[model samples]
Target chain A: MEDEPSSRPAGRPRDPGVAARVLTAVQDLLITNGYAGTTIAAVAQAAGTGKAAVYRRWSGKADLVVAAVLALNAPVSVPDTGSLRDDLVECAMHYARGDERATRVLASLLSEIGHDPQLFDAANRAIGRPPVAALVAVIEQWVRRGAISADVPTELIAGIIPTAAFGSVTLRQRTLDTQTISDLVDHVLLPALTGAHGSSTQLL
Target chain B: MEDEPSSRPAGRPRDPGVAARVLTAVQDLLITNGYAGTTIAAVAQAAGTGKAAVYRRWSGKADLVVAAVLALNAPVSVPDTGSLRDDLVECAMHYARGDERATRVLASLLSEIGHDPQLFDAANRAIGRPPVAALVAVIEQWVRRGAISADVPTELIAGIIPTAAFGSVTLRQRTLDTQTISDLVDHVLLPALTGAHGSSTQLL
Candidate 1:
């Protein structure tokens, strides 16, 4: 859903505040009405903006929804703890601390996202790629230091916590507590990365 | 969502075939209309039965939909391949071979299921728990044989493949290919379970 900037009539310089208001409206609609029920017209009405204004920013519902979700998520800061285990634990903690409203919005989008390629790509770009990138960078540093094997599938290793965190909220309706996050890092991720059982006693 | 057999008026013996038809209707409607759009009356109409007939069988839409999804999935046969890796591979293969329509139905239910505890538990019973039980059984056998450490989180180990499979389909919108499954088992599951890097070369 690419915006055709040229197709839009030369209008007043876009209102910066309008975009934020529209995104907030989108998130609200997503939580209350879900993907199928949230329409452009409804979002525009909720935002107190004209339908044309919404379309001017986003090509369609998928584009708008993806933008809303992206805005909702604050980027995870990449931690540079010297140890791979510590870096991963920090990342996992960041994921576990995500707010419930954002989780609900994501859960509400899951059904529709799976079916729509555009939405799926948009969601992946917003929610999936950044954390994986951060983890990859950390793992690469460890690999360079010979702390972990170069043969490890870096992307797969990176995906574990995010996948688990996503499953915990979206599938099981549970938040990841500190104990569970500690267990995951100590028991699962460390061992997978280092080819040695995690020093659970040492870490805990 | 539990069926109250006692609550049914002393009526004609239940038509075994009606249950099947109603479940089929639910699957069809779920694929076409999604969870929010699918209604009990519409399902009954689609099944060529009265609403009473549908409700007598299931308490409501959540109950009916869960049954429909359960019926759509054939139970995974737990493999006793003598190797935990082999057993996990077989299970992963079964998951990879799941038909597209069933995947679509599950995808459609995800949004509603996350919000409704009854639906969430019903879905966990139907879709989440059985394969996990099978994996736990296999892992436990390995633990007993001393092939893996007893300290491994058995349930978490059991959950890895299913979680990956779910993430592959629901989040990425891609089915797990044979190579990807082999990589996951060798590169991720094997290491996490045994504290040894997967023999990717040997396994492949």
Candidate 2:
């Protein structure tokens, strides 16, 4: 999953503060106008940047879409709450809330990307893996400290945690509230992480 | 989340068989072409029917897409292997092999549906809840059979299995091979399902 073949060139920053503003504009455009309606000129105007600046950074609509997704991909720093339960619960909330708008953009971007694997590489490099890697890093530390187990692959376990959150958003049309996320983390996610087996759970 | 406020349907079924054929064509096209490339004309061509026939069945392309997704959305048919290890491991392989093109299509479709609430009901009815509910049913049965704990919510436990498989496919570009799925089931997924706390798994 990790072997993406994109080398970052010395253009501007992949995402600068101005670029973030542009992506925020793109996100707003995405939510309001839908992907079909979003235009480079509209994004440039919204961000108060020049068209040249936008083009200088991203190659075309697909490239800009990926950049916007990357800007949208940034998850806030997860807190080390000393307990896995606390950390995950907090992470889920932060995850669910941070940029509902941005995440929505991903659905649109992925829609476009699925037909074209070339876009997948760009999306993976510019947008996809950073946040996932962050969570995996936390789980890796836990494994190192004997907090979690070495028997489990750090990447796989860490990967499942974020998957629940994104899948909730990806799978359904609901707003993906905090309580729903918390419920997932506390009951389903933790036990799965611990691998506790005895009896089946009651329906929720 | 449960209450979709504006879920009025356009029409009811006329010829379910024809609709089924159209939907099956849609699934094949989606598996083959993806959301962006799928068209009414193409679907009609593939199904050996006219475009009017498809329109009579669904409100639009999105509605048609919903049907295709639901075609593969059978509930969690977790195998009764008489052991959690065997059941979960088998479940992972099923996840890996069963209609992967549909799986990828859903990954993209899911995100797009988040942006369009009008299709929410159609998506849920056609594609969403059956599989998840099935997974929940199977997990609950397992728990009642003394295979898992009644303490966990079935919804939460249900979330984990797919969270691993879908998450793996969507986030990382890995082959969902049988052996890989087996490893995910036996080592990662099964362990997560059981509980990660114990030093070693004692249950079968």
Candidate 3:
């Protein structure tokens, strides 16, 4: 069992990329074996590291999974797609494009995290918070432009966008089609959010 | 091990309640322990049956869990709440209330199912198809009422609702709260299903 070889340069050829390599392996294991089946040994074998190397940084199997999944699914800075709706669509579509296996891995981890809320606390912090915050910034621009409601709480509601988008797979027993996702954004989300008040009366 | 006491009798002898009791217990285990942790032995223990009894009814653990979840979350049926929006909200809220452990169980089963989708084919058949099927029924009612578009393909969109509602909990690391649930029915879902034209624009 060796200590975690940090990313910094090493004098003795310490295989400095071990941590990242291990995390990637963990991601693969999570996709294949699932959260419960994945073990420290499996991660070690996949990463080409000893058990001690894994233990140096992670407390247990759950810790390893949290790190690995967050590495893969954690929201990055929101892309500046120029339009709020377009940017949100791209964000939703990022998870939408066929990657069923990764979606399942994320779904499984979510189940585990729900049961044991703390399992991914750090991972959630590292991964869950940032992109939603970025989304908040973008949507706030909408609020200011009066294209959308200033009354809308972006932080609270914006979080739902990605959750609804990437979550499309778990939501559908099969896979999500393109128009369903577009409807989710254009119709369901915007109307309820903006209260599209007069449209209903006009339709009548 | 004792056999699963058959279906509950009219007066309740002959151990007729065995199947019902066992299915219920297994479902409870699914929420608490998740799919991996919910073993046949554990289900037997919780149901107060012998391991042999469980095997007699189910080929394996997956069958047992699928039966349990399906029985618990059966189509309770939705009332025509006048408007499509109201019907959708009521359905969303009803979908939200249930085994607090459902989100975790869903994540667990969803992840593992990919490795062997056939194993869950029975589950998909017996337990999986009904509730969402019921929601599709609700959507159809709205379309007939002209509250929603007949062209909406309500069945397809209805299918994604349960998955999205439950997935919201897992992915967001939050509970399926009423407002969020309502908003989903409102903001993201209703417009797509309702044919609310000009929902995104009105120069407000």
Candidate 4:
């Protein structure tokens, strides 16, 4: 692949803000007009940048859309609250109260995921994996602390957390409130994680 | 308002199979070309029916798509197997391993839901409401039997079950299998419903 103009810097310095502007433009187009309507030319025009500048960042629409989606979900730091339950709640909250724009982008992306392997992998890596990984880390910590049972499937539990949170958002067509998030953790994840056993029973 | 020809005896009786044919055509277009690509003209052409026939059944694209999605889901009769756990498992399976075409249709509909109120309401009523209702019915049955505590927020629990099932399918980019469905019920739903206590204590 040809080196991106940003890396070479042959002429005047590339605007540092160009990347953010492009991503923002993509988000606006994605939310308002959807995936089919958004395009590189439109994004460049919206961002007030040359098409070359947009290309310097992402290869094409799917890559740019993927980057925009990932930007919507800026890396959530894993919660290390000393207890698995609290940490899991923190992770759930990240998704439960996540950017509405991201949810819109995710819906658009999910529609095409079955048909586009590249888009699917990009989304799975950027949008899907982080929260699950955070949950896994928290559950692993709990396992070490002897709070979670040995037989509990940490991976499945991790996957379920984000799924449940975002699923509600998708179904309701609205962002989840604090009460709903609390219910999700209290009623779903914590019970699944603890298997209704000892030590972690206090949340109930 | 002019009565639809199908409802009246105008000329030849409207073919009894027109509705199914049109719904199937919509599903095909939706799966292959997505929501943006599928159109009324194209659906009518594919279904080998006139535009009037399609319009006679549905008001427009949103209504047509909504009906097609509902058709894919058909009606899942709530299973009553003498235990709340079996009933919940049955409900989960309806979603976890639902028709692939329905999943595709749902993805397409979900993408545009934010912008289209007609599509949103149609989808909410057709695809989103039914499973939650079934789950609520099952949970209510258990509550009556005294198997599940009356204090449980059956509505919230009901929402979570399908949310978790559909969410997993969305995340994985594929339908869940039989074992995964069982695990979801045995490990996730049952534990959450019973709060990991009593007869459902096997998982812990």
TM-score of 3: 0.75
* TM-score of chain B, candidates 1 onward in order: 0.82, 0.68, 0.72, 0.79
Q: Tell me the tens digit of each residue's lDDT in model 3 across B129-180.
A: 6667767878888777777777665655675556555556565544566765
* Candidate RMSDs in order: 5.1, 9.4, 6.5, 4.9
Ranking by lDDT: 1, 4, 3, 2
What is the CA-based DockQ of model 4?
Answer: 0.48
In terms of lDDT, model 2 sits at 0.61
The digit string of per-residue lDDT tens for model 3 on A1-204 reads 354445536656655688898988887777667666678988888888888888877898877777776666545556676655676555555445665555555655655665566655654665455656776766777777787776554665566555554555554434455565555556445554564422212110
**TM-score for each prediction?**
0.86, 0.72, 0.75, 0.84
Stretches > 4 Å off in candidate 3: A1-13, A59-62, A73-85, A98-104, A115-118, A126-135, A153-161, A165-179, A190-204, B1-14, B81-85, B98-105, B118-131, B153-161, B168-175, B186-204
Off by over 4 Å in 1: A1-14, A50-52, A70-74, A100-103, A201-204, B1-14, B69-74, B100-103, B201-204
Q: Tell me how many clashing residue pairs each candidate has.
A: 0, 15, 10, 0
Clashing pairs in 4: none
- Tens-digit lDDT track for model 4 on A1-204? 121454564786666788888899998998677788898999988988778888877889888887887676557688898766677777777765646666666765666676677767767676777767887888888888898887787777677656665675565566666566667667766787785522334443
Ten residues in a row with the worst lDDT in model 4 chain B? Answer: B195-204
lDDT of 1 by residue, A132-153 (tens): 7787888888889999888788
lDDT tens digits, residue span A1-204, model 2: 111113546663444566677778887887667676799989888887767767766888777776676655554565687766666565556556645554556555544554567656666654456656766666666667676666665565555555665666566633466666666655545544555432223212
Of the true interface contacts, the fraction found in model 3 is 0.38
Where model 2 places Cα greater than 4 Å from the true spot, the runs are: A1-21, A31-36, A48-53, A72-78, A115-122, A125-127, A173-176, A188-204, B1-21, B31-39, B55-78, B115-119, B168-175, B187-204
Model 4 per-residue lDDT at B119: 69
